[model samples]
Target: MNLFKLFQDIEAVDGDATERLGYYSRRSLLRLGSKALAVSAPTVMASVLNEAYAQSSSVQDVLNYALTLEYLEDDYYQKGNAAANLIPAADKAIFTQIGKHETAHVALLRGALGSAAVAKPAFKYPAATFTDYQTFLLLAQAFEDTGVRAYKGQAGNLLGMDVLTTALQIHSVEARHASEVRRLRGLRGWVSATDEAPAPVYAGEAVTSQAGVDLVALTGKSADRVREAFDEPLDRAAVLAIAQPYL
Candidate 1:
């Protein structure tokens, strides 16, 4: 399909066709003058289309997916902070601030989605989740790590939209949260090959290759350095599955 018609189809599905049009723009299309599209290889265009459909069904769908995860995290932190002696007195402020950030994230996303926002889901936690400090820290690390991947996972869906910027700003904050939580757990601030906590969170995170380039071989970097240099992205389904037990 032609680019215009393809985006028209997307607009029909998610009402985001206008935004796509605005992003690509009629002027940009006019500059191509039809000749550019006419001579381009069919396989190349097909690959482009395939990537688009694989990314997401709709921008709203991706946002709702994120909203669900934020709901779970906000609920976890709020409950943990409220529990008596759950967070140590010295570390209380750290968790309290993180919880506030989660709450604010929920509010901001809800505001952005308005009527389109999904309702919060009930969460399940281990019996010792809040009673044991180690348990709380482990789960917190998992959630924060998962949040970082989840946000990166959704990047493809948010491309060419204004909301991508806001999502990325939130992403940086999640990265900071993950690093702090890891340090509190007596680990390095970055995800590494050695970090085996909650296997799924660290799944596909130890790769030393990116964009088909062997970072270790070409850059002469150690495997650990290569792996740690790039934070990996998880697809939507994998992220949701990691969150399933908690929901």
Candidate 2:
């Protein structure tokens, strides 16, 4: 599909009742709170999105697919933090901060989409292959790294400047989370040594299409490819399939 059409499709599926499920929007928050927080401006200016135009049949599967990942990350950290022994005392504080940040992100995205935000499907991630704390860190490193990239990958498909900007904001934070996790894992830096270090990039920030660049290049992958690695944008059904096993 062409880019705009793709975005519209994602937006359409994202608007359905199944996606909204149990959420209630206080119009007060929808107006005043969202503006104070700068949530509504981008989508409104770019897409002219309104509740009337949004329908369940019109929701975009890709958007919901992306939302599912955010839910997964938010829930993972929430649950992960509760496992007292899972995180080191020194790191627990920061881990909770990241968890809270992810929580806010999910909430922010949901609010921006209004009722179009998809439901959090019951999910269970595949059993982590790690056997030790360090190993788990490695997995954590991978997950955060993947998150940083995934957000970037999806940004282009978003038409509303407001939605794009908000997504970009979250994307940068995810990068920070990735860097911190990498450091904890004893990795030299967030980016591979051959790649630039400490620089953050996002999918919504720019548009580029490259495949498997991270795997092929020593410079680590560009921020955008991290999103692409997960492959095509997923619809609701596809997202639930992957996430269901995790829940």
Per-model TM-score on C-alpha atoms: 0.79, 0.55
Alpha carbon lDDT at 223, candidate 2: 47
Q: Which model scores highest in TM-score?
A: 1
Q: RMSD to the native, candidate 2?
A: 13.7
Give the distance in Å from residue 238's predicted Cα in candidate 2 to where it truly belongs: 12
Candidate 1 lDDT: 0.82
On residues 1-247, what C-alpha lDDT tens digit does candidate 1 reach at each position? 4768667555543454455445444445566567776665454445545545554356768778888989998999999999998888999999999999999999988876666689999889999998999999999999999999999998887776667877898889999999999999998899976557799888999898888999899999799988888899999889989999988
> Where does model 2 exceed 4 Å of error?
1-62, 126-132, 193-247
Candidate 2's residue-wise lDDT over 61-139, tens digit each? 4455567778878877776777657778888888889889989888876765556678986645445522245655655
Query: Residue 216, candidate 1: how far off, in angstroms?
Result: 1.2
lDDT of 2: 0.56
| Cα-based lDDT for every prediction | 0.82, 0.56
Best by lDDT: 1
Candidate 1 Cα deviation (angstroms), residue 58: 0.8
